[model samples]
Target: MPVLRPLPTQGAGRLADRYGRVATDLRLSLTDRCNLRCTYCMPAEGLDWMPSAQLLSDEEVVRLVRVGVERLGITTVRLTGGEPLLRRNLEGLVAALAGLEPRPVLALTTNGIGLAGRAEGLAAAGLDRINISLDTLEDDTFARLTRRRRLADVLAGVRAARSAGLNPVKINTVLMRGVNDHEAVSLLEWAMAEGVQLRFIEQMPLDAQHAWQRQTMVAAAEIWARLDARHPLVEDPADALARGSAPAELFRVAGTTHTVGIIAAVSKPFCGSCDRVRLTADGQIRTCLFSRSETDLRSALRSGVEDAELAGIWIAAITGKQAGHGIDDPSFLQPDRPMSAIGG
Candidate 1:
């Protein structure tokens, strides 16, 4: 690979769309392959996997990260996937990303099926933190929801990640009305006991069949009320730093500094403050998670495009970003791709 000319100071280049929201975070999907098929994330069978040759190489991912950091002023990155750990040589990619100049903060969103064995290597390779997707605490619920028998493995992975010093390990749970909503308080209590930060996400319309209905969503207000009824919640305003641009709204448990977060993406739209963009495993760049269109960077990259050209393609995608993802609108049309295809 040829070397590209370096840009000026890191924070000097601020990337913003027409809406004036600065883009400081990027989500890079490593692959679309995952071990488990979550009911809300993917169809049980016949998931179309992208040809391996079409996926970006480790060097390619690093180069884009460099362009993003140097040219677009992205300071934070999260590696997401159908399951990021399924990709071969992920630790190498982590190390490469960690070596960048003005190195951006790095993290991963994983299913945690095999994370128990990999946590130490990833932490040592300079990963900043991780968010594990674990919906219910029951093994029976796990099998029914995911159609898999890996609940024990995931729980073990969480313990291993904490033991490996993954600070404030976050567990992402999606609350489906009748599915996992009943466990809201139990999940919070579990997080408190285990010392892992817990975040409850409202189910979005990103499922495979477009079967997601508004009636299924458990509102953030309800989640809080349920938990508060059991254990009173007094807002802790001290976690102000984790508020802006972050999807999660943070609050401390009553009387103590322990925190709980609610990422109300649907009920409370935060598009105006959205600071993130996504790159699919197959190399399509999406400005919003609910975006109907994507810019094909893989085609451009394979054509041997220059750094400026690559940066321009990315900028064009961000420039066309809509004011907000119109999920609440009755006229909203779901994206053709599922969460797995869209990158976690």
Candidate 2:
């Protein structure tokens, strides 16, 4: 166990880092367990998940989020998971987070397996928006991409989210080189028709197998070329600028109000304006998605530290946030934990 760093007695404002970026968006992982074994994320057999005892209980999660929102300056809270729907009491958890004194804009990133049954309840429980992962539209391709044949379930979940008024039902699609790369335009067409936002994310180096290669990963330029050839996308500079710290670069679907986004994490590198921080399911603070070090808070929380002290620790952690994810550096090393363990 690493020793806890000394807390700063002052600076009780936002979660600002050394690079002058203030983090207001918090991505908290409810569980490090997922139903699918996506080829880009983890092995088909899945990973050795964290023990239930090591996982944060519902009460602990609520307390930490409350400290973040009330004490720190977290305005947006996105609940993530190996698959958040696996967390049995997710609706109740959403309700608790929603009931905070200064309620956050609660959102969820899910695989959408069992979401059809619970979308309405989640919406009622104060979930503001949702981002579902749908890499391919073809069932066979989806099965090959994500070692499961539940593409229909994901589609159902997307529709359910829309029906339940989860506005801006964003779809997060990771385009691999030869696999599912051809579906980029088709996916966008589906998203536009479904009245949802679509974002094509550049595949990063977070896969469990460590098999990712720059040559093999689909580039942002290639994605744009494919889409532009079909729909003629125009840069929505105003909308992109308005998003502020959002990673996605917004573009208008030429001559239409509908828009599409591309998160060129590897190609464009948005580290200069990153405003997000991640909290692992086991109560560790990850300043960056590719951070190798994690500050343990579960121990401090269980040790009965005051909320202020916890806030101090959180601030200290962010103070050491990296300038970039460092995927391009010669010294860049993939974190030991894969996306499944680290949370999307």
Candidate 3:
């Protein structure tokens, strides 16, 4: 349980942090139990999964999101997880979120293992779009990175998402040196043929193993050079400017209308304009992904506080948000919660 700092006066009726960043995008984790053990995320044996009893119930999740949307002005809600597809009543939860007043733009970030079967149902339930994580195109490399032989299932889920009318079904790929870094060009080519959005993300230090080394990690410049070699790249100024607060930097695959995005979180940090907040599966509010401290909202919710009061707790949580993640700083330290538990 983290301490609740004093709530700063609500500025402009938004979830504003001290540095003037307002959070309208909410990443809400549905569960902490993931199916795949990605090398950069979890250990091979998997974590001691959170007891289901400790997680926020569907009803509790709805109430918290309602406070976020109605009271705090959250406009976008992204359902994330250790793996969101594992949640049994996901469709029902989606429908409930879709019914919020001034209904939010709902999305989901998944690993795409079981998404093939649920894509259509989720879209029908009001999911706006999806982002599936795919690090490599080769089955052998996929197995090496994720410790799972479900690359076929992941690809199928990408197609299923498109079939379900989730336009621009984005694929999030992490480039790790000596792992899947060689597949950058191949992965982009595959995504181009499939007509889905592809984003190359520089590996960050959110791994549960805490073995990430900057020297061993692939940088944005390396990824750009690799992809540019195969397909000449040009910056999409229009899209780049329009992508305000978006982490990815947009570039057009020259000679074609298709575009690619790169999220240089470590190399070209985007902490200055970040407008996102996260809610852990167990009901902690984190204003930053690298947050060392989180405010406990579950206790207040269980104590039977009104929605307006819950809104105050949420405000206090963001009051002390740091100026930046400071990954490049000499004093930088990884958060206690790994990416899986933190809800990327």
| lDDT of candidates 1 onward, in order | 0.87, 0.90, 0.90
lDDT of 1: 0.87
Window of ten residues with lowest summed lDDT in model 2: 1-10
Tens digit per residue, CA lDDT, model 1, 94-128: 99899998899999999899999999999999899
TM-score of each: 0.95, 0.96, 0.96
Candidate 3 lDDT over 1-344, as tens digits, reads: 12234344649556988767789999999998899999899899998888988899999999999999988999999999999999989999999999999899999999999888999999999999899999999999989888989999999999999999999899999988777788899889998999998999888899888888888889999999999999999997688779899999889999998889998988888887889999999999998888899999999999999987899888877877877888888889999888889898
Say which prediction, candidate 1 or candidate 3, comes out ahead on TM-score. Answer: 3
Evaluate model 1: give its TM-score.
0.95
Give me the runs in candidate 1 sitting further than 4 Å from their true place. Answer: 1-13, 240-242
55-77: candidate 2 lDDT, tens digit per residue: 99999999999999998999999
- Give candidate 3's whole-model lDDT: 0.90
